[model samples]
Target: MDWEEHAARLADEVTDRVSRWREPVAAVPRHELVPRWWQQVAGEWVLRDGPCDLEAWLAAAYCDTSLVTSIGALHADHALGDEKPTGLPTSSATLPSLVVRFLRHARLTQGLDLLDLGTGAGGLAAYAAQRLGSRHVTSVDVDPYLTDAAAGRLARMGLYPQFFAMDATRAIPGTYDRIIATVALEPGRGLVPVLRALRPGGRLVTTLANTSLILTAWKAENGGAVGQVERDWAGFMKTRHSTDYTPGPDALLAHARQAEGDEVTAGRYPVLDVSAAWELRSMLEVTTPGVELHYEENGRRRTACLVHTDGSWARATAEWLAPPEVHQGGPRRLWNELERIRNRLNAEGQLPLYGSRLEITPDGVCHLSRGKWTASLGV
Candidate 1:
């Protein structure tokens, strides 16, 4: 199979949907960027080296799906078979369609300076360079190797966007007319640096970490940014201070699965995976941040578990549509909180998350308001 032909066809399909990004989508070689990736097989992540199987490589590259470029610090470059990495994905080539959608939200035009935040595989930056000139684009990531590797590949294609290995959550090197973050920013992580680095009147596009909220703001004259949550939802891997994700809630989850809790009650509804329910998940994350979730379905027995770094845990199990049996431990009764939020949803017929108004202060305080409810992140 001809990979170029496959890529061209993929570009055509993508352009049909995102008509504005057609040229860049057609020009960039996604297959080259993701020559090796991790694919889960029977609960273990295994390497899929594209060079070894050209047909499979074309198929995977052309498909509209994210490819795991790195698991923890163990990037596909150094990873081999059967050796399962313990942590979650640290980096990935986000699905091309979503990448185009992000670019669309950025409202790009020729000659505007742009920063492609989180240059994992440099796919977004490459597309930006292809649309705008290479000199107009700059890309940054915390991982040095990702920047180095992406730079070489991008240069080989005659695209030379400035690449930096720096923590984007902190100060960046230069200001930009537009900033688009492909990585998610954690709650309470203020947008001050991002706002400072964005030119006044320039637009910023990014998502909050662990939630499906897409934040789009323009730098205000008073050193802050004002924006709203976009109606469409998008999720990205959280930004990291280091190469791997922080140690997760493995211990909390382990204890929650088996240990008896302080209180046990029946759930108002069947066991539900909060992660799958974006609006409820976002509201819950806002109310109780830093929660990790795990869910499984075994025939009629569906189970949902929540664990937090603050020693809070909850387990809910149910059969089919029956109410769930809930167990709560630690300081918070998570299932009850969820039911409260769900009750709000039932009463209002919609969540306040989508289309909510956002007011970000100069010092990084993010105040979110929709109707009568309000929530704030940062001080």
Candidate 2:
């Protein structure tokens, strides 16, 4: 089938997922946004030039999945033929369904001013410009090249939204009635600048870095925002601090794997895969930010590892459904803490992580409370 046919089918798929955003999904050409993307092939991040490979491009573009447009600062446009870029994804055209969900949460009206933060591939901004007039939309990104390219692409489709290449985490270019951030923001620091840029009583839809929490809140009279974590889960690339992707703590992972921990004990439950539990993972991230997790399943043996920047580490191993041996090191017993949180969940049947009450202060500190559990993000 042709590109138009693929686009139409993709629109139908997205509409099936979300009927409210049918028109925008049908109208916007997602292929234009992801003319070239990165795909993991053979354990390597290889560049896929869509224009050169129309069939492959059509298949990936129309599918409901993210297309990585940039690796580190290496935009797919600059990548050589067959080049395999390394590092975590810096930017991508988010999946169509997720984009529609965010737009739905924004509660856009006919002529409300909208700020599209993190215009990677400009898909969301293009859709918004199509739904609402381009005059009412503005798109911004940290990368100047991405902004310039997205503006050009949007113009080709008659979308002329104002495009700015600036840090969305810092002072924005203008105030808006609504702001949708595709870029994941650091937990506490996300709210302040977004609230500052939002007009009084305006709404903001965004996600926190290192967690899958789609947060929606409205600007309040006190320069803060009040919101609740949506029941839905979503993830996006974290806001970058440098031109290249910042390397994670690989050095620590090595040590955490081999070093004899300060404390060792038998886990109350079988080795658990924390990543498989959304509520548990999100809650742990809120309470202990920047903790990295790894889990492996080998035959009947299940092993889990947790590493934190504070020199804390935990390892658990056991057979399926059997009590596991846990080793914890450093100042905090990471595994023990996880077990405590897990025990609470097993008893209460849920963690106070999703749909929890969130109160953000003017300085961007967020206090989350649900039932008897409370945690501060900016601490």
Candidate 3:
């Protein structure tokens, strides 16, 4: 298989718009950074190493899509036949189109310094060097292996930047004309570092850590930056500190195990995965706190539970032929609350986070103002 031909074909696919930075993308061998990738197998994700097939690897790497290099911050580490799911990406190089879209936003000049966070596969950094020169760009990543891998990939293409292995949450070594974070920023995640990294009036484009929120704010004259959500939507893998996500043994498990009483109400809303709900899920995590949801489905039984910190709980379980019997306990009946919220959305035709206006305070509280209710978030 001719790998170079595969790479050239991909270059042609993304040619017209990327022409300015064509040499960088075309020449920098993508197969090097993602030498070994992951695939889900038998309810688990597994690794498939490369330098293997030219046609297949090219198709996978340059297909204009997101390749899940890591999930739940466990980067393709766990061995097969031993664990339940493992290897969430601590980091990754985002898709090519997303990278170029952001670069187009940057509007690079001949000599402007950029702080590229989450260096990932180093592909974007290489493109930056091509556009603005290698001396002007600085890339940072939390994982040393990732930074090193990116460094090597960039070196092979004869492009190099001040690539450093450091946490972006800490002090940025120097001020930048533009700072673009590929990783999303969470509320509890500090903002001082990013603000301090930017020179006054510096423009920053990044997504809110876990939500479908994209922001393009400029550094303010006073201290912080101010901006609003971008009309479009983009989501990245959540940042992580632990080796793997241990969301605890499902806080809702016990509630589901022993459900009973008239507190049980038969409800009728198509069950949704709480994790997929983003903003509302985060809001519930904050307002109610310490809550968790669990899912289990067999040929016969299907169950899900919503459990909270203050011991408030709700659960639903059903055999294949029957509707779920809902149960509740503790102070507030959580399931009842969920049903109510869903009903409200049905009446209103939308949920709060969808197209909701956001005002981020100087202290980093995200106040989502929409319609009648305004939610003030804790920074």
Best by lDDT: 1
Tens-place lDDT digits, model 2, residues 1-379? 3667776787787766546567777777788888888888866898888888788888988898999888887999889987777777888999998898899899999879999988888999988998898999999888998899999999998889999988777778779999999987876665667889999999989888777888888898999889888888887877874555567878777777667788778999788788777677777888788888888888899988899989889888889989988888887888887888888889989887788888878888778777887888865
Clashing pairs in 3: 70-89, 71-88, 71-89, 73-88, 74-87, 74-88, 185-209
lDDT of the structure predicted as candidate 1 = 0.87
Judged by lDDT relative to the true structure, which candidate is superior, 2 or 3? 2
Best by TM-score: 1
Candidates' lDDT values, in order? Answer: 0.87, 0.84, 0.67
TM-score of 3: 0.79
Candidate 3 lDDT over 1-379, as tens digits, reads 4556655666666656546655556665676667656666776666654555655677777766655555555454332434344534555657776776677566566778998877877777877887788888899877776777778778776778889887677657899998877877655334667777888878777766545566677778766666655655677754444333446444446645676733877777655556576655554643554566666677677776787667777777777547567888878877777677667668977566655665555555566666886765544
Comparing 1 and 3 by lDDT, which wins? 1
Please report how far candidate 3 places residue 5 from its true position, in Å: 5.3
Instruction: List runs of model 2 lying over 4 Å from the truth.
Output: 16-20, 296-303, 318-322
Which is the better candidate, 2 or 3, if ranked by TM-score? 2
- Give the Å error, residue 376, model 2: 2.4
Pairs of residues at least 3 apart in sequence or in different chains that clash in candidate 1: none
